[model samples]
Target: MDNNAILNVAHLNIKFGGIIALKDINFHVPRASITALIGPNGAGKTTVFNCLTGFYKGGPGSKLTLSSKNKSNNLVEMLGEGFKLQDFINPPAFVKRIYFKMFGGTHLVCRAGLARTFQNNRLFEEMSVVENLLVAQHMSLEKSLLKGVFQTKDYLESQERALDKAHDWLKFFKLDKRANDIAGELPYGEQKRLEIARAMCTSPELLCLDEPAAGLNPAESAELSELIIRLRDEHRISVLIIEHDMHLVMKIADHIVVLNYGEVLFDGTPAEVRNSSKVIDAYLGKE
Candidate 1:
């Protein structure tokens, strides 16, 4: 485990009674970089994401560790405030993990400095674009709610900051004009951008994106590649992406990991991954 790695997942093994899902999986997400996880369908990509964000817990010997540079702290120490470390020391089973979210949920994951977007856009359908972004600041904004309700200076400042962050993301994605429109009403490409922007609003140190380029045309995917790069370079966020878009992955990823049957087949730079015969056989598969 690299001490500096923002996320270190090691020895992760999951099973369903008689069937195994993931076996001895291990990976690290470096700070302020883009690492792509690519594989075919049922390759255990989403299962990996679910486990990291606390939606699904692994069976035994599963270790998912997150770190922070501030005071060189471990997020497990401060996050899930008022909750004891014992609670997460041993996570629940796969089914119980789903119910855990209803209480602590992915929002707890967000507060821990990791946030994710689904392969399918998971937005508040009826909420306006900006509203969706604002809602993602659930934890931060809630702390100032009373002041906001009274329009006090502290809350007003907090609200302004949140809105400013939202506007910046919207502008970056070229969707400032659609900020007031209902989220679901937007076209697919714009909706994709919105989803990324919404995740950005949470101020995550590492953003996990699942198949962000799915359904996007070449032009849109190219632009998304640039956006992802900008997120890493400009916004200072590390990215762990599970995407099938090889072109986009090759374009923006600093590191790439190829997964086959829930285990890592290859892990290296874009050039290395692009040139690997093993990856070709397991994932790329004869062009």
Candidate 2:
């Protein structure tokens, strides 16, 4: 693990029955930096995101560790993998593995300072924009049943705070005026921004975006590029993005990882990726 990395992936291997989807995939998202994962369609880019966000589990010896706020979590372990050799020697780790096996889930991953948006917009279509954002904060909110039924002061205050946070992000994304409108009613570009805003409301140290620029026009993609940079510089959030928009990736990525047939073909800066004959021949040439 890099001392400065917010997320570290080592020896990641995924299989759907006999088909090997990802083999020994490894990378790290540096703290407060933008890292881009680029590849052709069916290159297992989204599979990596699914694994990171806890939708899929890697095979044994595949470790996904998230480090932030002086705490570290083994995501694969949290998703119910048993003890490793190291855990046997480390008492705390051994106990945590037991706890995760009993109580761990995809929701736990979000609670562990990581949040993500899907490739397709996964907004609550029938819900209002503000409602969608508030829902994202549900895990962080206190859920005392008695207080909620009685409308206690503490419960009301917490709800108010959640709403304030929701609107804060809505305003940042320039969706404040549409806060009362249906999330599905918003324009496609605004819907994309809203989804990112919803993820931000979770207050994650690391944000994973799956092809955020997929449906945007050129101008919208340029704006997204600027917003991603701001997310790193202004909000101090590390981002891991899976994107096909080479222009957007080259413009904003501090580091790039190129994948082909579920294997890493290149890992370097934007300049190195641009200059690599292997990357050029494999994917960029087709572009």
Worst 10 residues of 1 by lDDT: 73-82
Candidate 1 per-residue lDDT over residues 1-287, each given as its tens digit:
89778999888777877878889889999999999998878889898888787666665567677775353433322222233355566565433444543465555667778889998889899999999999987666737557757888877787788899889889999999998999999999999999989888888898999999999999999999998998888888999999987888888999987788978888999999878899878754676
Each model's backbone clash number? 0, 0
CA deviation > 4 Å runs, candidate 1: 69-105, 142-149, 284-287
Task: Give the local distance difference test score of model 1.
Answer: 0.81
Q: Which ten residues in a row have the lowest lDDT in candidate 2?
A: 278-287
Q: Which stretches of candidate 2 lie over 4 Å from their true place?
A: 82-98, 284-287
How high is the lDDT of residue 154 in model 2? Answer: 88
Per-candidate TM-score against the hidden true structure: 0.86, 0.93
Q: Which candidate ranks first by lDDT, i.e. highest?
A: 2
The prediction achieving the highest TM-score against the true structure is: 2
